[model samples]
Target: MIYIACGAILLALGLIWLIKPAKKANPLYGYSSYLAQVNQGSFAFAQKKASLYFALFGLLQLLLGVGIHLLKWDRYFLIWLLTFYFFILFPIVATEKSLKQFLIKRHELPADYVDPDKVKHEKTKGFRDRK
Candidate 1:
């Protein structure tokens, strides 16, 4: 019963995102990745990618959850947790990786863009180098 409920909630959230993904980066709302926050364009792209992948994976999770409950596999709680973890992580990682590749391919990322995650104090040039 609880498993089914959780699955339903996940499905609902995914549907909501599919209907209307967050447009901008906000601490309270959209996907707040540093790569996504680079600019409005990146923000929009990241949000769309994240929401799309999330909805897809979320649906998978819902089905898996239901299957678990139906099979009376309550002892496999760890499997459920692992599935949920991947469900949450897949979209975020995919979005960031996609955004990074897009920026690099287009050569649009700012020269001074400091990747705090990659480096400690290395300096960069600027933000959103349109050129």
Candidate 2:
């Protein structure tokens, strides 16, 4: 039970740590720098890559957290708290962080942008659930 909780903490941190967003010199920088050069007009490529990883990482973290709770390892009250924290607080944090980053990058785009294939321009309003 405790092992699961510990694993949740470690997994969450591990996924977050997987993102390399710094300017530190390393092998990854060579590839990312090349990507930046290819996308010299904007930071879209870098941000897109980062956002993809963010979503994937968050999904994995959420899944692992849910799996832990489903095992019913409620041997102590502390486990319940940790479970609640991971299922509730952790998701909120992850979603909020992801949304903030998405918005930030999106807002930086050209104001004249348009996607003709998008349904947003249609009269139909899509359902959106609030987090």
Candidate 3:
């Protein structure tokens, strides 16, 4: 019963994530890490990529929970509980690692490559413009 409830909640959250992924890399809503916050490109990419992984893993969690219940696996409750948490954690870790690798590769690329989404700073001609 607990597993079923947990699965349902995960499924619902996954669907919500798939439908409306976080648009920005704010600390509150989306995945937050130094690599992810490197630029808008990384931020958006991390959110979308992470959300996709999250949704798929969440579905797997739902199935695993249901399978445990149907198979009468209550004797190994602790194992199943730990597995459930691992399912939740794996995606987050994988996404962060993936993003880190991507950022490293991006940095290795040519200097001519520019992130279009990066905010442009205007030059101030006078002190008043700086205000």
TM-score of each: 0.70, 0.29, 0.70
> Sorted on TM-score, highest at the top, how do the candidates line up?
1, 3, 2
Alpha carbon deviation, residue 56, candidate 3 (Å): 1.1
Candidate 2 TM-score over all chains jointly: 0.29
lDDT of 1: 0.70
Candidate 1 structure quality by residue, lDDT tens digits, 1-131: 44455556656666776677787666876677777777788877777777777677667767877787788897877766655666667766777778888778867776777664786554558864444
Clashes of 3: 0
Q: 25-93, model 3: which lDDT tens digit per residue?
A: 666666676667778888877877777777777777778777877899878887776666777677778
Stretches of candidate 1 off by over 4 Å are 1-10, 110-131
Q: Which ten residues in a row have the lowest lDDT in candidate 3?
A: 108-117
Better-scoring candidate (TM-score), 2 or 3:
3
Residue pairs in collision within model 1: 112-124, 112-125
| lDDT (Cα, tens digit) per residue for candidate 2, span 11-98 | 4544543464434324543123332333333334444444444445445555655666587544554755555444334433444344
Scored by lDDT, model 2 comes in at 0.45
